[model samples]
Target: MTELAVMGPKESEFVDRMGLYYERLGGTRTMGRMYAWLMICDPPHQSLTELAGELGVSKTAISTVARQLESGGMIERVPAPGRQHHYRIVSGGWAQVLQVRLVEVRNLVETLDLGLAVLDDSLPEQRARLEETRDFFAFSNLDGMELLKRWEEHRKNQD
Candidate 1:
């Protein structure tokens, strides 16, 4: 009776769609379903056994996925009353995810810089293209970090 007992068709459909979206993000389909479910689950926190039953996945699957999500700063693990661990979505701006994005953008800029350094100066056309790429990545990293800062400010204002 503590469990959902039965998930509605619409809910299942939503989870399925979320799973697909997560798959596009380089994660397993079931992990996506688990995330979507956690976002809307009535009680907001659930034990591994509960999640396993709700997700129709093995406990090991839940553990693996939850650990991965946890490492990514997406989900959090907490202590349950029954000595088991509970899982829930980490609230707020997802600064860690944004940090990862910024790092990727920085790497892109670095790669572009390296290309500019190694490319032949005689090939004006190639040099120009690399310069353009370098400029774009540099701008992208700056813009992305600025946007993240604005987001933090917005969230702070809301608080």
Candidate 2:
């Protein structure tokens, strides 16, 4: 298997494109660039200066991206005694990110449930539509919860 540090041409192209896609999804281009760099860079935790140099960006840009990642729980800030703060991808980061997104999913499910209840007092035609919506969201919530449980188990195993 190829080492993580060495991205083949195809992988490099994919990573670059993914960075752009993430940018379109409300993340800054620099944040996406930093994530791509972290995925392929050697030694995991890169200094801001190193990432800035590698990505051909300024240190301030790298610093901002690092803070964004840190707050989003995608990366951790490591401050060793007398050393500058360094950033590393969080262990089981994807699972945690998914968990956070699931909160929104749960809220959606709850909103649907409320709609279903409101429709129960309406005409039969409206009730059918609302019930259908409720069923879908209920099933979705159960599935999301199952996936979350699995992720928790997987994270525990990794620990």
Candidate 3:
């Protein structure tokens, strides 16, 4: 295994900010830090041991978060020479994440549609609220899909 470079103060601060951002988005700080580090880490890939050492966490913790990230399509496991696992960010990882979110948005739209169906006609205000929320999500879902398509095209062009 190669020696991992020590993180400088600025890099560490950026990792911490990413951690907080991920935490706010319902993910662990460790996961966010690891993700941030991976984005800029040397050689573009790191093993569990390397990640644990860099983040001051246990290998088990890193492994757990790695699995979550892999399943979520943000990162992917790569084959290395030894038994230790390695991971790196995917090319369209953010787009994959957005795709997952759009699915959730679609689900919410369906739920709102159900709510509108069961809602009483007498409650005009409640119906209006549901209608507005549903409309917003529906439009957002459409826009998000278009955005993802455009992003993919742009990425392909870059490549």
Winning candidate number (lDDT): 3
lDDT of 2: 0.76
Between prediction 1 and prediction 3, the one with superior TM-score is: 3
TM-score per model over all chains: 0.89, 0.74, 0.95
User: Stretches of candidate 3 above 4 Å error?
Assistant: none
Tens-place lDDT digits, model 1, residues 1-159: 354534678889999999999899888998899998998886788888888998899999999999998988999987767778899999752688878888998998898889888988899999999899889888988888898889889989997
Q: In order, what is each prediction's RMSD in angstroms? A: 2.0, 4.5, 1.2
User: Largest TM-score belongs to which candidate?
Assistant: 3
Inter-residue clash pairs, candidate 2: none
Collision pairs in model 3:
none
**For model 3, how does the per-residue alpha-carbon lDDT over 57-108 read when each residue is reduced to its tens digit?**
9999999999999999999999998799999998788888999999999999
lDDT per residue, candidate 2, 10-72, as tens digits?
Answer: 756766786797789889877877887787677777778777776778999888889888888
User: lDDT score, residue 136, model 2?
Assistant: 79
Please give the distance, in angstroms, between residue 79's alpha carbon in candidate 2 and its true position after superposition. Answer: 2.6
Count clashing pairs, candidate 2. Answer: 0
Worst lDDT 10-window in candidate 2: 1-10
